[model samples]
Target: MALAHRILTIRRDPHSGEVLARGGDPEAHSLLERSGFVPVVRRHETYHRLPTGLDQDEEIRLATRAVARLQTVGYDLDTDPVFATERREPHYLSLGDQVRHLAVRIREAESTEEVADALTELTATHDGILAALTKVLHTAADFLQDLGHPADPHTAARLRHLADERLHVLASDLRHVRNDLADRQAVHPHRAPCPQEVAGDEREKSASCPCPAPARIPTTPSAPAAAPPAPAGRRR
Candidate 1:
């Protein structure tokens, strides 16, 4: 079995010589910082490699981060070399399972900080899945547009539709969760206020404090829709 590793890259600008790009997990960010690669204007881009692991939920999260990072650089599951050799089963968590876990975390979160963290994790998962699916559609479209249209046009079109539907589901789910979090944060004011504010208060008020402002959600022109089930036995 091949070793599982996380990789990130930094690209340099062709003219004027400067750090053009940088991305990856927190560790990668730290590495770039330690190496003196300050962010600068960019003219070129490239990918680099690094080797990394975790367990269960953490493994799934790491995989998601890897996918999101690659998608940022125009690579996807079909092209990322690490994915080709890496053992995926151990890290694979179904979308249903992920949603359940996030829901549980949000429900059990006791403090504002905890809720914020859970919301952040949920948002990241949504982003990672959406990025992967978007790339799938792009790749399919590009393939169908090529000369002779080597691939079956019907199949490519179906795949693109499925990806788009999945993306719609992902976005809808995320928006609902964000709205819920915002609502909860507004009314369920159980925690104490910030320390700095407490120190400044002469009365040491025990009033219900408001949570941080929730993430902004844009209104869609069309009404919301759910992802329809694919044919029997074919999972989304």
Candidate 2:
């Protein structure tokens, strides 16, 4: 998990850097910070080692869906002679490919453990895609800024809007993956009852009861009250 956390951190920082470069919302910094954390290394490693097959059909289906969505959002860089000349479409396609690969992995997974592993991979891949998108948008912003004119407000707005929208979607996907994993584990036959459940009331009684009288906190003796001041102008 720690390794997974590190991977996520590495992926998100670059995205945050891109967001900063374009003068986009600074709030993304907080969001990025919240998203990255040290994952449990043992658990993460276990998940990664789980065997799973790639579902090519599902991968293709997801890719097609993503492409359709991108199309709806006017993502036709190749058709735009100027954009095609600039050649940024390749970068976006690369990101799309990474996402597709992860999607395929997820679809192919057989067990809950394998699914969890795939989800982790998907999270990392999505982070990379977001980072790449951020870089491209920042590049576009920079190019416009270098044109001896103020950056095109419309373009900046659009790029920022897209970044924000994608971030939301990614967060939602992450949550869904986590919930699915939890649900799977709940139904896993091998799962042992919690220790607390086995111990029952005896364990609870052994542990200090929260409702018991509170222990007094020790404190240093208070300083003696200050002596009253001498009467003004009177002998001490």
Candidate 3:
């Protein structure tokens, strides 16, 4: 998803000097212009840095504030129900489950090495989810731009396409990461086996053991290269 350009337009108060607001849509500038105001060309506002370590309540609060501000400007900034009702709620629930699982593993860990490994995996998974969410937010911004209610249609369409492509790739990566973590948990219910299990005479030399192994199973193979088609002839 493309990063949105934060447009800074100059506005003047009755008694104060010039002030700037982060302008998005053209209609806003148009309204100001029609009301006997002039738009001054200046440097655009830098993008606001996102807050880190924000809990779900903080996130909802921030989002609600933004929506409220937009509402005052006659813009309808509704939260996507799919994220709230379906994807995000479930995703967070699953994340909580994973955290609980990791906590249990940490508590039941036999050694410091086992606890460290589990914590590392949990941290990596948490980071992966954060990156996925960032991608989703960026995609949403691009999607909003593409609605063309306040932006140029051509530019919006291009941004929309790019956003769609990016979202697809991010979603695919997220799915792969989730699946890998799930597979790892299923195979390695606990920490690695002790030396006794490895040295046991009853231990089979089978390749398909339901335990974490040095090697991973190949999911799929690459397809053969396809030949390019001939160029089409021009019609008379």
Q: Can you give the TM-score per candidate against the true fold?
A: 0.29, 0.31, 0.24
Task: Output the worst ten-in-a-row residue range by lDDT, candidate 3.
Answer: 82-91
N/CA/C clash count, model 1: 2
For model 2, what is the C-alpha lDDT against the true structure?
A: 0.42
Q: For residue 224, give model 3's deviation from the true position in Å.
A: 83
Off by over 4 Å in 1: 1-108, 111-128, 144-151, 186-236
lDDT for each residue of candidate 2 in 82-195, tens digit (9 for 90 to 100): 112221212134344666687676565555676676566544454544455666776776566546545476676666666668755875688688558846854333443323
lDDT of each: 0.50, 0.42, 0.46
Which number leads on TM-score? 2
Q: Model 2: which residue pairs collide?
A: 1-39, 1-40, 1-41, 2-39
How good is model 1 by TM-score? 0.29
Error of 1 at 117 (Å): 4.2
Instruction: Give model 3's TM-score versus the native structure.
Output: 0.24
By TM-score, the candidates rank as 2, 1, 3
